[model samples]
Target: MEKVLSKKRLQIPQVVAALKHRNFRLFWGGQCISLIGTWMQNVAQSWLVLELTRSAFWLGVVSTFQFLPMTLFSLYAGTLIDRFPKKKMLIFTQAGLMTLAFILAVDTWMHTVKLWHVLILAVLLGVMNTFDMPARQAFMIELVGEADLMNAIVLNSSIFNAARVVGPSVSGLVIAKLGIALCFLINAVSFLPVITGIWLIRLPKPVQPASRRCQEGIWQGIKAGLDFVRKTPGIFVPLALLAVINVFAFNFNVLVPLYAKNVFHAGAKTYGFLMGANGFGAIIGSVILAIRSAHGPKMRSLFIAAAGVSIFELLLVPAKSYTLAYLLLGITGLWVITFTTNCNSLLQVQSPPNMRGRVMSIYTLVFGGLVPLGSFLSGSMAHAWGAPAALGLGALISLAFTVALVIWRPSLLKQEISFKWQD
Candidate 1:
């Protein structure tokens, strides 16, 4: 009994091995604070757009504008991230985002803000994030080596979702009591922690290739990354699924706000709570992944999580009661996190050290790039058929795609991912 208890005690540290690394801890703490503010701005932005336009189509337009740059620039951004020091690059990107947030805040505070202003700022933010997302994703390896890579990724997801929970809840209160501008202002201020953290981070310099790749030009690097993905089934299959998910089923920003207002006749607080419910479920899923971080990927589990998300989302379409809809959304959140975390951890673990940045940029692109397209379609559907129809249709498409993939390539589902790409 004593031996068994000792083993159990020893397992605790293994679950949180990434936290032991000083650099990761600093980055994680600062990013946690900043991401909370980011989520606040996300809720506020959607609400602001909804208030101003009263058109689901316009709401989709705003989302499309904001994320378009990510699709266009992410491939190039990946090359730049690989060529530079990710730490310093992130500092610059964070500062740029902070500036954009401040401008939005001030404009709204002065009562001079317009829809066009928000749209243009969204474009700028998207451009900045094109650079930021890949750098941040790739930088994780430098903080904690391969042995703890999955743990670190899972922890990062937990932090992101934790912010998702707090940010939306707080933003709802602030929007109700204060104003929308304050949310952006608070988000602007929130960047200070992450910027300061980046400045203070100390790590051994990354080893450079004997000959720098940039000297030959970035296109070569981009081509190599593309080739790697095309040739590798392990990465290709998951990435293909991610793109489908993004295009058909990842329009939560557009769907949730519309549902709150149209279906429930609820205010910002209710919408915020619904968003918070999703985050809370995500937190639960993240914790589970963190605890089981050491385990290898289960092909069956991955497909099930994907299918689970679509099923719950479809069920939410017919849910008439607030409680039922909220519960379904939470379940959707849980499975979405599980599916996403699995994709991210698998990609990171599989890629070679030199290609990690470019690989992750592809990851970011698929994850975020297709969002604009999804948002636009979802909004159009909502405008014509209602929010429930839009969400249900998207979810159905995702489910169909998952089923088709499994049937077309059963080996893709059965093969165990060894977490390393073969050269």
Candidate 2:
């Protein structure tokens, strides 16, 4: 009995090996709390927009403004991330985000919230995220190093999805009972823990950029990052696949709300429940990745996950019942996280230390930066043909793109390179 107990204790760390590191544990815990608030705000904000405009196109517009900064300035942000301390950059960005949430909360509470107000706040939030996303991604290496990097990334996804599950469900309850303003207020308060966590984190001094690299202009630094990506096929292919998937298929912020409200004649509670179902499946996928972290990423896994996302999305097109739609979305959520986590791990592993920030910035650019375009496309389509048709069309484009990508680069599916990190 004692031996079995000891064995179980020993096995526990392997499941969450990244938590053994002090810095990552601190940041992860804080983020775990904070992201739930972020998700709450996401659900509330979408429902709020739908309420104000009664138009899906406006919802897309809000999403477009929110991510446009990433599209416009992510390359510059990447160069800045490489040049400066990511931790400090993150602190500033998080503070900015908290402030925006507060402002929105106040406006909503006062009953003066306008569509223009939401749009403006969203653009400011996007500006903060432009810096935050890449810096945060690149910072993971410093937290746990390459030995546990995959675990750290997967664990991060796990918390994010976990928050997705909790936040939206709670937001529905909060929005129904208290008000939408309270969701934004809670999100504003949630940033405190993460900011404190960042402040407390200690790290070995990061390698400063070379004098020559630092001396170069921002545009030159951006050009160099682009050139590196262009030369590296391993980094390039996953990003290309991500771009297609993100642009066509990642319009859930627009599609899900419209589907819940317009198609089902439902309310905030229904929207939250659907989003929560998706988040639940994503958590399951994250657990799978966490268990397989020791093996690192596989190209085959990446491609298969991408196909699964499109296939599940295609299934969603035919889902006429809420239960059917919910089930399909849950499966879609699983594939979405798996595909993205693999792409992220693959990119980080393939990038050199000096170029890591720039590489991940490009990753952020494709994964998130292009979402504005996708939002607009999906929103416009949803407005015209309905949410199901918009979703089906995007899935079809993504599926076709995935197929062509494989045919053009057969080596990608066959290749599964492994790496040993040298401190």
Candidate 3:
């Protein structure tokens, strides 16, 4: 028994081996602090929008304004990341986001914040995110190297989920006591640590372009990335499924708040608790993936996780009791981490180093870009039919996708296709 216990203890470090690297440790530590504040703002913003507009339709509108830029310019942003120094680009984006948060804080403090002010700020942040998401996602492998990419990605999810748990819980207290403006102010200040960490870190020399052909121009770069995804089944299939899921299943930002306010007749505290519950489940899922990094190809894991998410979401629609609702949300969170983390890590592994930025940009475009549409649908559905129905609609769409994938899984998994492209 003592030997078995010792063996278990020995395995713990292997699970977090990515943290042994200096650059990644620094980056992860900074992001852990930053993401907590980001989640806080997410909750506070949703509540604030509800407070300001008193309409779920406007909630969707706000979300659409925030994410619209990703749909418009993420491909160009991806090309920019591929050309520029990623860390520096991240600094600029983070700074821009910080400035927006501060503007929100001041506007709220002065009691001058209106629906237009909020929408404009959301649009600005969305613009920053178009550049930020792809750069950050692609930067992770560079920090820890490809050998530990799975562990690093899992750890990253764990931190984000940990923040998800902590942030809303804290925001609930802050909103209840200090008021909502403080949440935005706190989030703005939180960017400092990450900015400082990025500035201090040293990266290895970048690989020179092996062929001038790939670097011909911005349009060529965009076309190259698109063509790669178009032809690569391993990458394209998962992305297609992810995009479908994004459009219907991943409208939590809209659904959760509506359910708290309209369905449950709860306050900000209850909403925060619900979001925290989801985060708690997500952390559990991330831990499982961290421990077993070699869980086979990502597509298989993604499909399984998607099914779990859909089932839990459907269960959530009928959950009348607060406890039962929390339980269902938590279960959905667990599968959310598993599905997204697998999709991200798998896509990273499948792409060449040169194309990683563009591929992830496409990913950001599909995922972030579609949220506006989903949010609009979710908000509109909630306004018309109530929150439960909106939630059910998303759950049903997710389940339909899962059913379709299961039907096609055998042939999809067996087919071996080359990614080579000829123009």
Q: Which candidate is the best by lDDT?
A: 2
Residues 1-423, candidate 3, lDDT per residue (tens digit)?
Answer: 999999889778868989999999888988999999999999999999999989999999999999999999999999888887888999999999889999998999889899999999999999999999999999988898867777888998999999999999999889988999999999999999999888887997767643543456989889999999999778888888888788888888888888888778989998999999999999999889898874434566788888888888888888888899988888899999999997887688788877888999999999898888888988899899988898888888988987897797766645433322211
Q: Which tens-of-lDDT digit does each residue in 1-423 have in candidate 1?
A: 999999888878877889998889989989999999999999999999998889899999999999999899888999888888888899999999999999999998898888999999999999999899989989998898777888999899998998888999999999999999999999999999999988888988557763575674788889999998899877888899889888888888999999999999998998998998899899999988888888855566677888998999989998889999878888888998899988887787789877888999999899988889999999999999999999999999999999999999888777777767422
**TM-score, model 2 to reference:** 0.96
lDDT tens per residue, model 2, 1-423: 999999878766777999999999889999999999999999999989988989999999999999999999999999988888888999999999999999999999999999999999999999999899999999998999888899999999999999989999999989989999999999999999999999999998655545645887888888989999999877888899999999998888899988888788888999999999999999999998888888889988888998999999999987779999899999999999999999999899888877888999999889889999999999999999999999999999999999898898888898976763344
Q: What's the TM-score of every candidate structure? A: 0.97, 0.96, 0.95
- Cα RMSD to the true fold for all candidates: 1.5, 2.0, 2.9
In candidate 2, residue 357 scores what lDDT?
A: 83
Choose 1 or 2, whichever is better by lDDT.
2
Total colliding residue pairs, candidate 3: 0
What lDDT would each prediction earn against the true structure? 0.89, 0.91, 0.87
